[model samples]
Target: VVPGINEIYDPRTKTWSEGPERYFPTYPALFLTQGGEIFYTGSNAGYGPADEGREPGLWDLESNTFTEVGGLRDADQLETSASLLLPPAQEQRFMVLGGGGVGESEESTERTAIIDLTEENPRYRDGPPLPQGTRYLSSVILPDDTVFTSGGSEDYRGRGDSDILKAQFYDPATNSFRPAADPTVGRNYHSEALLLPDGRVATFGSDPLFGDADNTRMGEFEKRIEVYTPPYLHDGREERRPVLGEGPERAAPGETVTFATGQPGRIAEARLMRPSAVTHTTDVEQRSLQLEVRRGAGGVSFTLPEDPSLVPPGWYMLFVSDEEGTPSEATWIQIGEGLAKD
Candidate 1:
């Protein structure tokens, strides 16, 4: 945990290379967002001063350099603050939600902040606040482009009787939050949530120190995983669900992509979802984009986003949802030509 060193592993070459050292130590609650650029937030430790400056900043992968972005509403580093990249919109934006404040007081906060990356000088502003102060909660992007947050603790270190069992949904279009179904088990401290290919959300894991198997209070660990079916899935439209078939594995941004579908006329929407990089309630890279679709006799055509800054360069799962909101089995597609790091 001291003297943080950075390293990058090349999956193609099966090799590792030393990267420029970080100014501060990296730990849980720290998050990284990826588009063409990568951004990070949260503190270096549970309770302490933040690395470099307290504000979240961008990291240059090519040069291994870090640049601070200005105008943060809350510059003080907080523990377990949930930072996430919202679904693709006119401009790229990131949201930082509830978390515990720094120092021994370690009080929880309900403040929410936003950063617009498209601006010449990106800065954070106050967004819609949460229903209550929370930390260590899991947030995921839904198929409809909204965000859902569940299970967290009201205090730092997740002490006795601090669990938050309710769930909430954030709608960017409305800039407001509403209530959602709660999970049966609590997910605080070490919990996570990820969107599935079929559009359902799977959540699990919670390891409070004294609640693990080694400790006498085994029930507190929360071993069982749970899957949540969104209201759209239960709306009685299963018979009209679309089915995805063969398609190109990759293409560049703005390319016209075509794919086969069993229910061509029934298809209503096409979307691309980036795989989640989730841990400790922070998933900075999870994103989804709606593609413009045109239905043909035997297949469908869609155009990808023209801006590399919006879609980035990576492998994404493509899904076509029917009018009833049922999504097809995902087909993997890599976006853009691979960038040479060297």
Candidate 2:
């Protein structure tokens, strides 16, 4: 069986597990919902008609299942994209929007569809179609109920296939489209937007490694990253906030580690998700620090306890809850006594 689109590991046994059987396109952007469900859209149904192969759909994680929502998938829907709504509200259901399928007999679509996941029978509903047609664009949901879509090709066949600078934002409440800040360069097929802790959004991708001139997908790949600061989020005053950056790769036993946070803030607690070694399911081990937010000229720093026995040599994550008691960001730390030691 094909492995699920996005796979998770048990962490205990160090074994990995796939989500569910959703006829996923294997290479499409996936969004994980607050409810732990996975939804992916956009793909060509290799066996179907040109249009039949390209449809946008989703898969549920709890039941280990997949469901085809509603989309015009066909051979033409070559590239698919999906982004889960962040800061999801009770009234607003999970929202996913994308480009692909067919907008015309011989080409891909400029149309966008919204799925109301909160509905009992979640189905696709009409969303404001892109003012300009496009395909293979990246989508991201912001904290303010704003969905941003950027990059992608417009009118693939006739337009000479140049990258588009075009991008837009959608307001779920009004079901309307509004213009958002545009990127300096035109990119499609390889781009992604990530919401930053300061309420700004960062978009990366279009790496040359991921896509090429002949095959757009092969040249846009890159390890480089970029940030996008939204004007609407500026507060004039800069407040010290903590952002959990990427964590350690592996941890052995007895290694002193520094946590990752963009700006320093109070680090109150810590947790270790132990690898099962057998099943790989993560088992939670809570270590109480109850530390207070100490201010410094440079920034805040949290010191790990001296006992190396507290953590075994393996992969573990350090979750630091801020003074507010809300878990800020997780830092992956490896505890060990050797080369794996940082």
| Alpha-carbon lDDT, every model | 0.72, 0.47
lDDT of 2 by residue, 163-278 (tens): 56766777776888888767765554445555444445566554323333454453435345556655443453124334555445654443334544555545544444332211
Error at 96, model 2, angstroms? 3.8
lDDT by residue (1-342, candidate 1, tens digit) is: 345566777867999888666655335333334355557654323533544434568877777777887665555635677877776543477888887766433477777888877777887788887777877778898867788888887765456556788888888878888999978887777788998877788998986645533334533667899998777667565444578877788888888888877668888887788888787677655778888889887889988887876776798888787776677667788887553211
Sequence-dependent TM-score of model 1:
0.83
* The best candidate in terms of TM-score: 1
Which ranges of candidate 1 are over 4 A from the true structure?
28-35, 43-53, 61-66, 103-105, 210-220, 250-254, 305-314, 323-326, 334-342
Alpha-carbon deviation at 57 in model 1, angstroms: 2.0
How does candidate 2 score on lDDT? 0.47
Clashes of 1: 0
